[model samples]
Target: MKLQTLRLSLALGLASALLAFPTAAHAQPAEDHAPTLAALKALQANAGPGAGVHAGDGSTSWTLSTGTGTVNQNRPIQPDERFRAGSQTKTFVAVAVLKLVEQGAFSLDEPIGGLLPGVVTGNGYDDTAITVRHLLQHTSGIPTNGLPLPQAGPDGTYTLAALVKDGLRFAPAAAPGAAFHYSNTNYEILGLLIEKVTGLPVYEAVTTGVIGPLGLTRTSFPAAGDRAVPEPAVHGYRGARIGGFYFWLDGTVYEPSNFYASGAVISTLKDLTAFYRALIGGEVLTPASLAELERTVQPGAPGVEYGLGITAYALSCGGKAWGHNGAVPGYFTQTLVTKDGRHASVVTNAHLVTNVPSAQMMKVLDTALCESRG
Candidate 1:
């Protein structure tokens, strides 16, 4: 399957990696305990793949990595190894835009036509009709760049203008603010906005504005054409469904430049969990901004309803956790942070396959969050 199409499934809540609830109660003792280890082990053992799950409660953290780094091998997955964070980059971009908003540089309701005139008009896309808020909320009606397999290598150069034009070739998905339709193109426009406003590339802006200030030393935004993840990274696998069955193939070297500000960030569980806590815990945004960041569109779904840069999920155990989950071709990550400050992150090496650590993994994540309650 194409990566953007699969990612769109994630946007529509079809392939939401953040499980709301699970039935089996496999609770382990909390004191000096690692509740996710056994579940993760079982997950890898049963699925024939490696996985990494991490949970933190602001003060303490635990990680469990099982299976092999490569297929048909015994090399254990590293607890700190990085993976392509996919659309999680949206959260970073959202935070940057919020910072710009907080600085009085732009208003959420500002129309795109005012921000970038003549840049977004093409193939039925009305740049003047969409707003920055519409872009952040995925209600901009922009369509995704329908690349079957992105032809860009890690070193290839492609402009954001080119990507926006690529997306414009397709008809608009819906009218502005008509309904939620997640498109990577929305963030691509935002990336261009950042560059236009700040005169820095999107990656440089995020690095200086978000990653560096947060002290996320292990996280990185790879330069264009830098297909290789930092050393000590786990190999990513491709799971293709064929004739009602699935097969696995190696896909670790997949290039990320094509995703750009939409989904190109790479991070480890530790860094990713820290980012979730910091983001949802009110560190990166003002109280008013955080409230706006979490303002929901639905009553019961809570975080399931999309917000500015985050998704608020109504935890099955009562109370809501704010987070966003991301999926690329070879990796899928579910990162959740409860309002009470519990954070959980799960990462896998394979993509779009049957049983990509679904319920079993959610059970582990829930137990981790529940343990933080007491």
Candidate 2:
């Protein structure tokens, strides 16, 4: 089936699920404790028809998407909807690498050259200068070299190695460990390294070690040939200014293999939240490794720190939240988890538009959800 048709089908499914909820149910007191569900529903309601929210703590999880059959031209958004996670894939790769570290595959300080020879593109520093830690922490100073690949057509799959080769034109920005420059190439190489060390594909390693163990069945590494579509997947749209008129481009599906380890995973909010909780709660990595992941570097951004694959943001709520914010061509997603693993994750398919209703919806949901924690 065409990608757009698939998206329409998923959206319709979500809308149907949402409309199944009775609107005439007993009106609970607004002041009642545990307002996460109600707050999420309110956010969905405000987003108009075809909007949904899935929220939970350590105990229970709930999903709610509201609307009638195939609302909004058969493109209703769903709760378990899968979207391009973008840079959030970095965390998954980092976790996989950390698992290898814990299994005595390599030390954090071990040089990347020893793991994957000739993967580094430029040469201000030798392979000896770059370590596994350097790549994970974004201190490798590798220049970001992401090239937009055209979507799959009648041609076959494009391998990750081809994507890396396409990115090799750029030189390193600084000496390894000298500064923090966000580079998709860093994780791309890390993905290659994971494949090298494990003797399995990067996708296999992540699925077997991280996603499978955490029970995140909603998540997977999508590739060109794979027909395994995530249920309730949202169709991503991009609004572009062409000749002073704004036009929306529909049915733009990103090639996950092009993103590779940098931005390939597709997941639901519930699954993403569960993964964050697992990682932050020390269930995924050792306490020492987790500490290393949380350690701040002096690359010089106020309240911004790099820990392995995660980004640490000091929240106004007097705690540190770690995760990544991601923007693909047609999606924007943010996943934030406290040091203790409590978190708020939001994902939207509306992209490159001036007025983003998703952002407003997220803000409302976050304020209400966080206030409930108080």
Candidate 3:
């Protein structure tokens, strides 16, 4: 955290100086983005030791990476390296559900209780009161299981039903559609709905319905028993938590089942950027569905709002970007697509104590998209 805090100071200074310019005329030069990348690499080196950025508008694009994949290995982060997408997986799940809605297979306003019966009922949670739209919007009042990843061990695993049962042990956070509460349980339920309606595993449903159609060949959802990320993947690390002390913990490989539908896809920045642009550009979802995806309500996090799986962030620079950001133990990722199709995607191998992307990391995203606006 000390390292990241210092990096934040340097990054802000760099951002201030860079933004001072009038944003070089459109199509000026590819090197015009070098300063943004320099600031990003500096932040990455100090924050997580490894990171990459994929940025550009339709006319110009930049792919860059900084720091090493492994600590002290001198193996630099590659622009094409794969890593866990974390909760960003939600966008894919949401898109899949929305596709079903478009095909007349599911209705957003329909109560999940009617679709799954007694499966979602228990511990004071009334599934009958929660609708598919509520689940996607995180207005279903569902509480997270509240279990941290490390507690689940390296081989963490759980069935969707089991996770839901554990989550139900706590009463619903709010009445149905009462207010916004971001809950991993919400997406897990959507995963079940997909399974129920399509009669397929959540992974297969997402692959066939979302990933395949987009031709994201490098992206994949690992099975519960799988612990190894495919080759050319970046190794992730975290600050070790021992009795009141912190040390470096290598988080390169671990069962992804603990993340499940909430955060279990492996992908590169390239594929992520493409997916986000298509989603925000209305290539995958219908106008009605896209509207549902962009319609947002404050989720109690400052400057952040939640939509059906998608998130809208008001950039510090000016203008807003639509997409979701995610974090697992060893990775933090974000994809932001502007209204005019300018986009940026970021991936970091180091996660903070809070598991949230650092301000400096976010600044990089902000600058990349903001700089590309003109």
Better of 1 and 3 by TM-score: 3
- Residue-wise lDDT of candidate 1 within 1-374, one digit each (tens)? 66565555455653423222112212222444455676666655434356776776757776666656665555555557888888889999999999999999898889988888887787787777899999999888875567643444354666677777677777888888887777888888899999889999899999999999999988987766678778678777664433423345556776666788888899888888889898887889999888878875542332367898788766667887777777777787777888667888877777664455556656657766766665
Model 3, span 1-374: residue lDDT tens: 34474355445554332111111112123466776676676566455656678888866677666655665555656657788889999999999999999999879999998999997787777878899999999899986667743334344677777666666777888899999888888888888899998999899899999999999988888767677778898888765333433234567687777778888999888888888988988899999999988888898878888889998888877878888888877788888888887888888786776535467667888888888877
Off by over 4 Å in 1: 1-48, 149-157, 239-248, 298-303, 353-363
Residue 182, candidate 2: alpha-carbon lDDT: 83
- The clash number for model 2 is 0
In the range 1-374, model 2's lDDT, one tens digit per residue, is 33464456555554332222213111123333344445445443433223444444455444444331132354444556676777889999998988888899999899987777776644455788889899888888777775454433466556666666666566778888888888887887888888888888888888898889888888997755563335577655453333423223443465566677888788877778788878898888899778887776754766667788888766545656677867665666767766543566765453453444544554534543355353
Stretches of candidate 2 off by over 4 Å are 1-76, 121-125, 149-156, 227-229, 240-247, 298-301, 353-369
Mark the regions of model 3 whose C-alpha exceeds 4 Å error after superposition: 1-35, 148-156, 240-247, 355-357
- What are the RMSD figures for all models against the true structure? 7.1, 6.8, 8.0
Per-candidate TM-score against the hidden true structure? 0.83, 0.77, 0.86
Which TM-score value belongs to model 2?
0.77
- Among these predicted structures, which one has the highest TM-score? 3
Error of 2 at 210 (Å): 0.7
Q: Which one is best on lDDT?
A: 3
